[model samples]
Target: MSMKLITAIIKPFKLEDVREALAESGITGLTVTEVKGFGRQKGHTELYRGAEYVVDFLPKVKIEVVVAEDAVETSLEAIAKAARTGKIGDGKIFVTSVEQVIRIRTGESGESAV
Candidate 1:
């Protein structure tokens, strides 16, 4: 079966809930990273223009999970449910196809690599 990579950019605080949801959905492995960027909302500022605009870097967390195609929907739903705090900066999710996977230490392939 083919694989899918699900990447989610979420608020930092909701990470724990997302992790638990993933685990509950039978997703055992995922990679998380702290990232800084802006979206359609653009950047924000504070104070007078001359007095250090104080642009909020906007803290975010990135979660990456690879799963079989059949499991993709479940994983996506889990992430959505867990990451949804109904806040302005909750971030977004992206899903893409993966051709193959290989385990670094054991040389395993396919879903085992996940």
Candidate 2:
């Protein structure tokens, strides 16, 4: 069976929206990581102790989901639509090949494992 991996780095605040969207798409499994990074959106400047500072590596949430090939586009669209904020720091989505998946408990692999 064909399988795929999708990784989305989104603004921290959008995590809930993305999660709900994914669930609505019949996606029930995923991995999430608290992360920090920058792109064209770059970092921001903040005031602390009456001082100005350039805060690097904006806080972000990395969401990783694996699914059967046919579900890829739907999942991508759901995540993108949910995460969009009409702002520069919306973040990015990446899709890549996943050669294998394994569910240790049931000894399931391939699409079923995902």
Candidate 3:
């Protein structure tokens, strides 16, 4: 079966809720990283018009999970539900196909690598 990698950029504070939701959806492992980025809203600031404006660097959390194709939709829904705060700067999610996976310790493949 094919596999997929789901990467979601969400507000830092919602990480815990996302983790819990994933676990509840039967996802056992994931990776999280702190990140900063800009989106459609672009950058905003307030100060002297003539001076150089420093763009605000918003704090975000990147969550990565690998799962079987069949599980992708559920995992995505779990993350979306858990991360949604109905506010700005919530971030985004991206999904991509994974060709292969290897476990460094045991050399496991397929779902085992997940």
Candidate 4:
């Protein structure tokens, strides 16, 4: 079976929802990172202690998952539904082909490694 890598960038507050959704979709494992970036929404201004500052990057959560090709659609739907807030900064999801996977300790490769 072919494998795929799914990457999603979403609002930090939506991480938990996305995780739960993925798990329910039969995706058991994923990697998450705290990230900062800007797109169409750009950044915003913050007023602190009488001084105003421009925030160029916004906090976001990056989620990465590897799954069999057959599971890709469900995974994408799960993430999109869970992360959507009907507003700007809801973020984006990307899917890419995976050439191979290897389990370091077990020496298992391909779909099994995933």
Off by over 4 Å in 4: none
Winner by lDDT between candidate 4 and candidate 3: 4
lDDT of each: 0.90, 0.94, 0.90, 0.97
Worst 10 residues of 3 by lDDT: 40-49
Model 1 TM-score (2 dp):
0.89
Give one digit per residue, the lDDT tens place, for model 3 in 37-76.
7786566675686786767776789999999999999999
In model 3, the runs with Cα more than 4 Å from the true position are 44-53
Q: What's the best-to-worst order under lDDT?
A: 4, 2, 3, 1
In each prediction, how many residue pairs overlap at the backbone (N, C-alpha, C within less than 3 A)?
0, 0, 0, 0
Cα lDDT of model 2 by residue, 4-82, tens digit: 8999999999999999999999999999999999999778899999999998889999999998889999999999999
lDDT of 4 by residue, 1-114 (tens): 899999999999999999999999999989999999999989999999999999999999999999999999999999999999999999999999999899999999998998
What does the lDDT read for residue 7 in candidate 4?
99
Q: List runs of model 1 lying over 4 Å from the truth.
A: 46-52
RMSD of 1: 2.3
> What TM value does model 3 have?
0.88
Give the TM-score ranking, best first.
Answer: 4, 2, 1, 3
Off by over 4 Å in 2: none
TM-score of each model, in listed order:
0.89, 0.96, 0.88, 0.98
Give the Cα error of residue 34 in candidate 1, in Å.
0.3
